[model samples]
Target: MQTQTKTQFDFIIIGAGSAGATLAARLSENPEFSVCLIEAGVKDTSPFIHIPFGLAFLARLTHLGWSHNTAPQQELNNRRLFWPRGKVLGGSSSLNAMCYIRGVAQDYQRWSDAGAKGWDWQSVLPYFIKSEKQQHGASEYHGDAGYLCVDDLRHTNPLSQSFVNAAEHVDLAQVKDFNGAEHHGLGFYQVTQINGQRCSSAKAYLSNAMARSNLTILTQAHVEKIIVEQGRATGVQLHINKKTLLLKANKEVLLCAGAINSPQLLMLSGLGPKEHLADQSIATIVDLPAVGQNLQDHLDVLVQYRCKSNVSYGLSLAAIPTYVKAAYTYTFKHKGMLSSNIAEAGGFDKTEFAGEECDIQYHFLPAILQDHGRSNALGHGYGLHVCALYPQSRGEIRLLSKDPQGELHIEPRYLSHPDDQKVAIAAVRKAREILAAEDFKPYQAREVLPGAEVQTDAQILAFIRANSQSIYHPVGTCKMGLAEDPTTVVDENLKVKGMSGLRVVDASVMPSLIGGNTNAATIMIAERAADLIKQEHSSA
Candidate 1:
């Protein structure tokens, strides 16, 4: 490895995604601390990244995405799932479906119970409020003034409303807000948007901090490994512009590289399981057995239906004129089909088999989405995505080789547990119930996926195995827990166990997956992590 001149900073953060962007921006707020943020992708300057409805186009743009695929799964008929992660300035927040959900109180309580002390709902609610800029103003559960914008969809499609009506017809309560007092109700999901545009973490937190002299942001900087010396994280080795450079961190080195990359980076730096590192010929520095275990994600299956009317967003030669008019309308007023965030409405509900908490989450898309919107289907259709919130199966991220640029092995082990399969079957039945409600009589045509013949539990299970895909919420690879726990990678303060000046402040450190989306909780993690870093420094 060719070495270039070294640069020093008080804190160095890897992966400027949802968590890193927020951490770097927050840490740089104090002029006393100099912060450096490194991103493997380029700037978030693409128009598709800024527009609320442009996620479909951004999802396929390989340059802006780290399009990683999972290892073949034995449970899913040996199928490898596609995982799209943001490689831009704002990270996945710039490429995600703008939905803003912070999950339920029980989720954080489970974390605290599992050794993530001080991360309960009450302890972390302040950080959520501190990072939010809710459009509905301040409340006991929300904030009015913050960097991240949280607002209702600018324009809701008629088909999306029909889904909401159908959900209500099936005995589900019509909730106006999902992030309110209760989470077990069907409703329209608020999103991370501002004036019909995407308000990503880079836009929310990093934009204001860019002009600050104390903060330095580097784009297209691929981090090779964390530099650990004598059981302390001292710096990071990055490959930028075809050259190797060492960046020193005087105080701390934070890993905010999400679940997949965070664990991969740790292993690359010889901080993972001893056996796994030995297999790859990498020297073990920490011998941490839980660097990439306990992988959890929302495995979703889509139940699509053909729409009788053209009200749904779908590709057709007859809709060219309509699309032209809609484009014109959006160009002037920013309100029309163009402003719709396809999956405009969704909700949470508990099944009969579920406990007091909701086990199934829904995302009603106005358009027929398949393979993460990468494939094209015929005719106009609408779809409802059903995902099991709390899965029992666990996966892992293993190093393919010692080379940092080599592909990392990601195995989600989806539907490995028998209970998860049962929940999947139940969620599909509930989705079919919602679609067959009286409110959807006018729009209902016929079920496209699974068809009407696939009714038996065995048939539904088979369909779930064939059609289920990730909803893009991967977490718990580097779990935070009690020190005595062998699977715990970090402690309650997010500091890596058996190591000093190294912490993980992202979804990877989550002891367990949240009941809802991971983005909001990730931002909250960074907010609290900033406070923890400051407290440690003040005491020193």
Candidate 2:
């Protein structure tokens, strides 16, 4: 047996996902700090990852995706849902549909009200602006020069535009910016792209910082556990090339491995519930019962329509020529069909069951999507995906076993809450109404899913149980709250409760799920966390 050598850094960040990438870049900017970013996935060098429309291909690339599956949900007829999380450098930001929504201001207000102190919209808005390089330029709500590129879709399908038109025809205002003064209404989504290319956090934040000698990035490194001693996280033990090595952190060990991995890592490190850890025959370092609790995710239901024409993206022998032309167009001009983000046009709307705030979010796809676009359908069609933006249901992530590389017990328990089911039913009805609007008559052929026959509330509920899936937004597993709150894993400063020199800086720390896409919010969390880290060090 050989003793492994230990490498040291001023800061050690596990999981080079959205938050980790941002933290590494920001912390390393000061020459005094040596930051080490470790990722379990490979580099984001895949051509498909950089192309805007390549999301269709990237979703199925298991090499770059975690491809996690949830436990059977009792509400969804005991069917497990597929969750594709980014395993690469930029994390899900590299694989997600590039929609750059910042959610609504009230979402952050809810966080503050729920005990995520100082996380209200006003306090967090600047961080959002600081992370954005909006193509529309700076404004009271946006920034001019930031790392993440946010711009309108370079190309949108005709059917997508019609979806927006139909939404407006139904009295939904046409919003030019979803992240602006208001969040309600229909619009074309701005994406994390620059010149039709995807601008993942890796490209946005890490590209410039990679050249710095103070920052070191290691891919294909899987962290086994956090090395905690004397009630503090001092380093991490990871495996690379079948060799387990130790990496010490002089300042802090930050866990930014997204929702699922972060909680799983904590449990493996003997920092979870005492009973749960003891069941796995592991010594308990801390009895943080909330380490993997409070899991939440948006449950999305798709309403697909068979198009009257071939305008929607579909696969057929006749479409081969069109695809070839698109390839040429993308290679030469970086435009055309290849520049689309598939779910190009969407909106936020209030369902009849919603309160004062809009509750349902729509993601318009210019193609018939079956199983997150994994299956193929025959004809050209489009889909309107509606999700209950704020779900009352909560699930959890637990270890299936003590093995570091073993599968996790992911239970999002979608629609478990009665109100969540009621909202889901209403969202489906709303999507149907938008597609059936007079403005979409020219393009609409027929409702192919949960068809006109499936009109009754009972029928809609049945459809929801049989077909709903995750929109791929999972958060709140490692909730942030006051130190006295037993359900909280981390404090307002993101430091692990009852521990020192350790922090969780990713979506897992979200006290609750925001009412829209979480990528932007996750980045915002990282930006603010970076400042918190710097502030603490400066004061020290």
lDDT by residue (tens digit), candidate 2, 294-380: 999999999988876788888777778988999999999999999999999999999888788899999999887676757667778
Q: What overall lDDT goes with each candidate model?
A: 0.89, 0.90
RMSD from true fold, candidate 1: 1.9
Model 1: per-residue Cα lDDT over 1-540, one tens digit each:
223344999999998999999999999988899899999999999988887778767767889989999999889989999999999998999999989999999999999999999999999999999999999999999998889999888788887888888755787788887888876767788999887789999999999999999898898889999999999999999998798889999999999999999999999888989999999999999989999999999999989899777778878887788789988987888777777778888899887779989999999987877668787765788889999999999999998888887888999999889999999999999999988877677875789887999999999999988888989999999999898899899999999988998999999999888998899999999999999998777434
Top model number, lDDT = 2
Error of 1 at 145 (Å): 1.5
Off by over 4 Å in 2: 1-6
Weakest lDDT window of 10 consecutive positions for candidate 2: 1-10
Q: After superposing candidate 1 on the true structure, give the runs of residues whose Cα lies further than 4 Å from its correct spot.
A: 1-6, 538-540
